[model samples]
Target: MDRRHKPSNILPPGEKLPAATVDIDEKRQTVSATLPNGDTVEVLLYGATVTSWKNGGGKTENVWVSEKAIWDGSKPVRGGIPIVFPNFGPPIKDHATSALPQHGFARNVRWEFLGSEKSESGTSSVKLDFGLYSSALPAKFREAWPLDFGLVYSVTLSEEGLRTIMTVRNEGSSAFEFQFLLHTYLRVNDISQTTINGLGSETYIDKVLNATKHEQTTPSLSITGEVDRAYIGVKQDTTSVLEGGSPRFDVIRDNLSDTVVWNPWIEKAKGMGDFAPQDGYKNMLCVEVGAIDGWQKLEGGDAWEGGQLIKSLL
Candidate 1:
C-alpha cells in the first residue's frame, strides 16, 4: 500500500467510526473497503473485479460471488461485478477491433493501485482508485492495438450504496471506440421472486430471439428462462427489487444508457465451467448497467465516465 494513500478516519479498538479503511486482504492481492455505516465492498487486483458487498445495517449480503469462481489468476471471476471494457464480447474485426477477449481484458488483467480516499456529507463514503495504462500492458497487447489509453477505476462505498465508476481517457492522438458493461451478478433468495423495474416500454434486442428489437411488454420483469437482452436508450434510472428475501437490493445507476438483463437458467447454468453449484443460476440475477449495443467513440484527449450505485433496502 502507498503511504500517501492512507485512509482519513482511524478508530481505536472497541471504538466505531463512520470512516473507511483500505487494506490488502488476507488473500494477498485483494483490496477491501469497509465503511463505518456497515457498508462493505471488496475487489481483486486482478481484473479489478468487485467480489462482495455486504450491508452491515441489515447484516445482509447483496453480492452473489460464485463459489466455484476461479481465483488462480488464470481467468475472469465468474460472478460479482466484472468490468467490461473496449469490447463487450468477442472482437468484431480482429485487428480492427479492440483485440477483444470475451469482455476485453479489463476484468481479466491486473491493475495498479493508485490510492484510497474518504469523504463525508451527511453520510460518509470511502473510495479506492486504480489505474490501467497501455504502457503497463503486455507487449503483444500493445502491438495488436497500438493505441495508447488510460483508465481510472473508482470504487466508492457509503451508507447510501456502493458505486463503481470507470473513466477512460484517450492518451493517443487517434480516436477509438469501445463497448462497456458492469457484469453485475446480484444475489437473490429466489430468481422467480425477483423483479427488475424501470424499463417499462424501453426497446431491447433479445439475443435469444434472433436479435430483434422489441419494447418491454410489462413494467416489471420476472425471469423464468435464459435472458440475454441489451435494452437500449435507458433514459431514466432503474430500480430492481428482490421480494424473495429480506433487505432487498436497490440497484441504481447514472449515465448508463443500456440495461442488460440476463439469467442462465438450469440448462445454461450446468454448461458453464466457472459457475459453481450447477444450480446456482436460480439464486442470482444479472441486471447489468452498461453502454452496450452501441460503441462509445473517444477522440484524442477526450474522456468518458459512468457508474452504478447499489444499496440495500429493508
Candidate 2:
C-alpha cells in the first residue's frame, strides 16, 4: 500500500486562500499551490498530474481532470498532464510490447516531492519539483525495463497560468532511447465550438483513419467527432484559443517536436472506464506536446530537457 502524507513529508509554507487557512491541501494526497495574487494549481501525488489550474481573480479553469479520474494509485489519472515517457503508445510487435505499460510507468508511480521555491519568473509564483529514479524503483519494476534513468519534473504556478518543465537524465553505462510528452487536457465549454489553431496546415498521421497521411487544409481545426491525429515536425508555437471560452492556451514548446490532437467522442467515452459521464467528451480536448515520431537517443550521463508553458490570454 502507498503511504499518505505524514509529519515527515514536510509540507510547504503556502499562501492562504479566501476562506481556508491553508492553501496546500494534502488531505487527499494533493498539493494545492497558490500564487500571491490568488491563482491556484492542484497536483496529485500519484502521478504528479496537475488536476486543476485556475487563473487569478477568475473562476474559470484551464486544466481539465476527469471527474471520474482514478485516484487510488491503481492507474494513470484520466486527464490533466499525464507524462508519457519511454513509450507513447503500445509497441507493434507482440513480445516487445509486453515489457512496458501503455504510456510508460512514470505516471503510475509515486514521485518524490522535492519541495517548492519562489520561481524566477519575478511574478507571484511558486515552483516545485518531483523526481523519479531507477534507484528508487521496486525490484519487480526494474526487472521489466532495466534501463537506469532519472526524471526531474517541475511545475510552476503563476497568476497567468501553469508551466511544466521536464528533464530526463541517463544514469547508466549504456546509451538509451526514450520518447516524451506532456499529455495536456484543456477544458472547453463545448468541443464543437473549439477551434484549434497552429496545426491546421501541417502534416499529420490520422490515427482515427489507421495512421493515414493527411494535410490539414484550414488554419484552425474544429472537432465534430472522434479524432486522433499525430502532427510531427511542428515548426511554430501555438496559442490554441477555444473561442467559445476565453482561456487561450498558448502552448510554447522548446526542443519538443510533435503534437497530438485528440478527442474521444461519444462512443469511445462510453467504452472507457476512466472517462465517465459519456457526454464529457464535449468539455475536453487533449492537445499533447511530445517527441513521439522519433526517439531521443541519450548517451550515458547525457541529459535532455523539454517543456510546455500554458498561459491564459484572458
Candidate 3:
C-alpha cells in the first residue's frame, strides 16, 4: 500500500486489508490496487467511471456497475459502475428527471474505502461502501424529481472475484419509482469461445424495443452484436453461469429477479474513445444483474436490496 493512502481495517477479524491500496497511475490514467491476499483489481477511469476489476491471470475486467441505473454519463467514455436510479432506460421527463446525472453520480464521484471482512462463506474480502442522498446533491438535483433517498453500494473483493451488493433505502415520503443493476463487464479469453450456462430455461426482457417481453422461452443466449437486454421476473432458484469453459464463472444473486447481458462488440466499442483496445471485445462481456421492467416503487419507510456473487471455478 502507498504510504500516503489511509489505512483502515474495514474487514472483520481473520481477514486483514492489504496495506497496498488504490493509487492513480497518473501516467497511465489507471487506478490500481493490491488486495490483502496479493491480488490486484485495476480501473481505467476514462469513459467507464468505476474500477475495471482484473484478477491475476486477467480473465474478465470490463463490467458495468449499476445502482440507481442509467446509461448517460460523460459520453464517449462509458464503462465502470453507473449508478442508475429512479428509472432505467431513456429519461422520463416527469417521473425521474432527477435521476438524470446519467448513470447517476456514483460512478462520477469517488467512493470511500470503509473496511474489509470475511463473509458468511469465510472468504477474505474488502468491503467498500458508498452512499448518496438528496442532501449530498447540488441545487439542480434538488429542483428535479425531488426525493429523499440514500444508496449504499458495497463492493467486496474476494479471493475468487468481486461480490457487489447495493441497498436502496427510501428516506422520504411519497412512494417513488426506480431501477437497479450491477452492470458487470466480465473478462474472457475469447468471446466466440464463451457460452454462459444456467440460463437455459429462463426468460429475458428484450431492451432493443420498448415492448416489455422476454425471449428466453427457450432459455439460452449467444452473444452476437450489442447485447443490450434485460431479463426479468426470474425466480431466486436460478443460477447464471458465464464461461468459455475451463476458466468459468458462475453468478448467483439473492433477492434479485432480473439479469442483463450485454457487450458493445466491435462497432459500439469503436464509438467510445476511452474504450481503447476496441478490439478487446474478445476479452470482455457485460452480464448485468438487475431489477428493471416496471419501476420499483418504495415507500418512505421501505428499503430494497440485491447482490451479485461471482465465483470462479478455474
Q: Please, what is the TM-score per model?
A: 0.90, 0.88, 0.75
Name the regions of candidate 1 deviating beyond 4 angstroms.
Answer: 1-18, 120-122, 244-247
Candidate 1 local lDDT, residue 207: 86
Model 2, runs deviating above 4 Å = 1-26, 94-98, 119-121, 245-247
TM-score of 1: 0.90
lDDT of 1 by residue, 32-122 (tens): 8777666678888888988888886537778788889987678999998989987886777644454556787788788988889776344
Per-residue lDDT, model 1, residue 186, is 87
Whole-model Cα lDDT per candidate? 0.79, 0.78, 0.59
CA shift of 275, model 1, Å: 0.8
lDDT of 2 by residue, 213-280 (tens): 99999988889889999998987766475666554677777667799999999999999988967798
For residues 1-314, write the lDDT of model 3, one tens digit per residue: 22221222444456333354555565655555556556556544332234556565454443533222233433323445444555565665555654465544445443334333334323445555555666766666566657788777666666756666777888887777887766666666677877666566566666565546655654556676666766677664335444555546677765667777777788977876567576777677777677776778889878887767776555
Number of backbone collisions per candidate: 0, 0, 29
lDDT of 3 at 244: 52
